[model samples]
Target: MRLKVIIPVVLISLSAGVLAFTKLGLSDDPPGRYEVIMNLVGQMLKEGHYQPKPIDDAFSKEAFNKYLRSLDVEKKFFLKSDIDRLAPLSTHIDDELKGAQLDCFRNINTIIKQRVAEASAIYPAILSQPFDFTKEESVVLDVDKVEFPADSVARYEAWRKMLKYRTLEKLTDLQETRDKSREDSVKNKTDQQLEAEARDKVKKVYDRYFERIKNRQDDNDRFSLYVNAITTTMDPHTDYFPPDEKRQFEEQMAGKFFGIGAGLKEEDGKIKVLSIITGSPSWKEGHLKVNDVIQKVAQGDKEAVDITGYPVEDAVKLIRGNKGTTVKLTVKSVDGTVKVISIVRDEIIQEETFAKSAVINGTHKIGYIYLPEFYSDFNDRNGARCAADVAKEVAKLKAEKVEGIILDLRFNGGGSLPEVVEMAGLFIPEGPVVQVRSRGGDAIVLRDRDKSVQYDGPLAIMVNEYSASASEILAAAMQDYKRAVIIGSQQTFGKGTVQRLFSLDDFYPVKDGQSLGALKLTQQKFYRANGGSTQLKGVSSDIVLPDPYYEVSERKDSDALAWDEIPKSNYEIWSNPVNTDNLKKNSEKRMANSAAFKLLNENLATLKKLEKQESYSLNLATYKAEQKVNTAALKRYDAVNDKVKELNITSMKVDLDKIGSDTTKIARNKDWLKARTKDIYLDEAVNVMNDLIAQTLPKMQRKQQ
Candidate 1:
């Protein structure tokens, strides 16, 4: 992985909440907080040759207050009052910093600097920590530890062992397969004989251990832990790219970098192919299929190396280099035969995260708006604002005389908080949209100062397991104000915390007067009006739907912050004549009859069964028997593909090879992407609105008569 070097700037007062200070007292000229801040700024400008605006006392105080408010655990997570208390040292530091005392300022700066060093030094150690499986049996640890949960630690170690064993097993199986192929070819085998012999040999090779650990609980636990560890460091956005497989993460976030235009992921100790880009080299090759496990990766002229325990980032670095380079991956087919395939790297651009609108057929035309993320170019003033773009989409829909709107925030992981608040304002009359409480119990209610509702009609917000941060805030507000009906999966990804990145390089003069350092810190917590923090316990939906996440896992399932409540503020609910109960009933009836819905339920059942297996034997005979069962299941699944195709659904195009190879679950995420595109949930939501119109319109007609 190529690390980008960023010049650090000294930590000077940058916002309203940060305290400022001058020289310590007792001198003829006692330096004030502002003067102290100015000195730091001057040093950064002179030493680092970096220019930054000087923050006034007001801005510093506000920013500081915001950061403090985020640390109030009781306010964010639903911890008991006693848990809300900060360590005495932290409290003292907060008080001193807020007071802007020069001595205190220096003390706080020293602590912050120490933390930066600790974080940087610990980063590498974190990656190398040996996984210990026994720790998973312990029950004393809290489920919400952001760093390492004992169960996860144990699970990760177990997974590492199992993966290593699986790698060796695969190599043995491959050698056997090659030997059989060579023997059959030399035994007067015709072309047809050779092909049949090869296929059978591969099938037998894979069938050996296919079912041995298929869908094991430990497998799932380990994969989830690995993903969490990589994501725990850096800002929430920076992820570790594993070496050999998984394509979904890259395609969905970074657009594209290099290697085959395929998404990959490790699920249950097997490499699962996700998706193949439409025009990528992989798509053209047609050799790689979704769900294929990547057994090994090799550079040009190097012996294939098993990358079972390699970190995702290291794997990605090796796979992705300058475009046009060829990388070889040894992939295990679903039937269990291995083949070495080569792919050329290319760029995959994301053109999907754009404003898309649709008009739903209803008594009152319903406007549909999907905002993927709050993306913007920080360097450009006129860069796109997802919120602003969404507002415009709503306006356009209103112009078309639509009576209601559905804002799809299904997989939106959140970007900018301000944008969400602004977007919420576009729907309701001016009022408090959210409340923010700092460490000192200081509460600031953010309101929509603008009184006009951009398009008040009827509103519904759609979300799922992936909706987080700002998405949670928006959903909570809509739920609080009764502005919209929240619908979808059990709950969203519970991540309500806020973070800020600090450049450590600016803290002190370069040690040798040379390099710079940087750090990202978790600073604040976001709360919903009515005093409920959306931290670990995400906002619940008014109406629930059958989603895979509901049965398998949820935001709260991971090591997450707890849920808590605070004092409620006076807020008014929106007045609407629609009958919510009736809407729910109608949706329930529709879902019961949908074929797609039934299929989803069946798949969920199988997934649950797979998630429960705990132990597996290393015996070869047992492994081979397990492989046969898995082969049968795959064949059954393939048989159903014909049915899926017959449905003629645009989203039902299943290319097993592509889906199997994608590690990011992007291909299987079809269920999610399909839910977003041909949104059955949205379809149900629209029906609810139509029913509302039907009931209300008749009553209005009667009144008029």
Candidate 2:
């Protein structure tokens, strides 16, 4: 199944590097900022990257093609003629990196601008006319499955089919709503009127889509994309972060930001609210709600800017500013009422991204900890960190007298390396956590140093294909020590590389307050304590689950680094190990008898089958038939856990006391507890915890306690 899970791969990065760009830094002639950054990044990747690929003709060709795809991934903007026009300069990118003029990027950028303008007119004209639903045609949604349009006529046909498909989608949804709604106005509409309305809506959506593309995506944004295409050709994780993007990445790593606390998404060309953070400005203001369409954003008394077709990131930039500053939003509610709301932005702590604990009570009381990421804030000495937060959670769970503990690292993308080492030490005795190797340098083992074990009871870690970098390191360490039973997908996301951000200004200083962005370069590789790299081969689970994201992984990316091995670090296994064989057999038997799991396995197969069938029919009747079958199949397995019996779970008394009388926090905590009530994975994890308690208990207490 293609789940489309967007998660960070690996982020164990150092902020600074050795002064290796001395010659490139102090050149007499300081070039433009873009050229300076390009040369600086090239030198850093070549000299500082853990395993640098040769910057030669072959690499240039790949980077050239990658940049083209990045510009028009859908193959809609560029034609066969455009690719042919740019073909001659494809192998000259390396020359540009080696002090030549950047002709390739300049030419490609110019052509894309022209094509984007051309395609803008194409979509509106196509949507103006009525489509014949009687025409039976199929469109391949996957870009790799189709080639660029041969000429302008073919391009127009492509746009027609695409617009028709979009119109059909809206028409079907409108039909479904009319059939289900009780209101007389919607229920009485005829098919012909509905089709026209759908076409109009599609046209409006494309109008805004093109408007944003034509206006907001500037030359700098396109340049960043080109830089990323080059860096990612070296490895998927390495990237070029412009200043604002770098700040956003740091905020994500810290699990907080200064904003109105509303999560936004671009839907039908409108910026809509997805969620609101608890105890933040929007939550306190209480006007902004889910699905509210934000039309304009103003800074206090300043004139408002129309943000109707603004991308989510652009809207966010307009909304968020210095703390205590007022940002006004003009919102359109779902009921069609429009109102202007003003809110003073503040520090929004995303507690949802932090470590939280819940007690799962069945035959035994088990503590569950969900760590969204390996978050850390090095900038603030007193800032919240995952290691300290998880330690606090563990202490609370201990006070609750839970029998066993389960650590869920399912979607943790990873953060600071040192923090993960300390977090891993909380489980096992002082030992090696992970190994790191620089370019042509000996492997260095990062050790915990502490001899104390915080939790010696039965332990288990939950992982999936999205458990990457630091998550893999922790899981691999615990598994190597035989401390925790790894359970979830077949293996975790295999991102075993370390990266560091190098500020371009450090390498090439420019005058007049010019700011050059930073490069997040891959500087090292990660290995488990057992010496096997986690690069392409991630840590395997002791008990595998029927995961729906089987196809989403690092291995799928052609540019991912290769897996290798190093000498095993000196360490000792846990003196007491969990009997994984018994746990595996027990889990297998439980799954074998589960009807939910049976349905899940069947649904997975169906999803796999549907995922392979990429082409979709545009004819109304045929499309409806296909969607009806597919939708029903998915509906049967969607939220499968909701069908299972709810497991008894609750928050600790200390947590309740800490959250006392804060209505929003209290309600959010309750919702958090309620969400996991019927989680199939957690349900079985609770069962495994019960079995472990039974297996480890003393002879007398086995039956009594």
lDDT of each: 0.53, 0.85
TM-score to true structure, per model: 0.53, 0.91
lDDT at residue 589 of model 2 (Cα atoms)? 96
> Poorest 10 consecutive residues of model 1 by lDDT?
73-82
Runs of candidate 1 exceeding 4 Å displacement: 1-351, 361-364, 376-379, 510-517, 550-559, 577-579, 593-595, 617-682, 692-705
- Provide C-alpha RMSD values for all models, in order: 14.7, 5.4
lDDT of 2 at 458: 84
Q: Which structure among the candidates has the greatest lDDT? A: 2
Candidate maximizing TM-score: 2
TM-score of the candidate numbered 1?
0.53
| Candidate 2: residue 328 Cα off by (Å) | 6.8
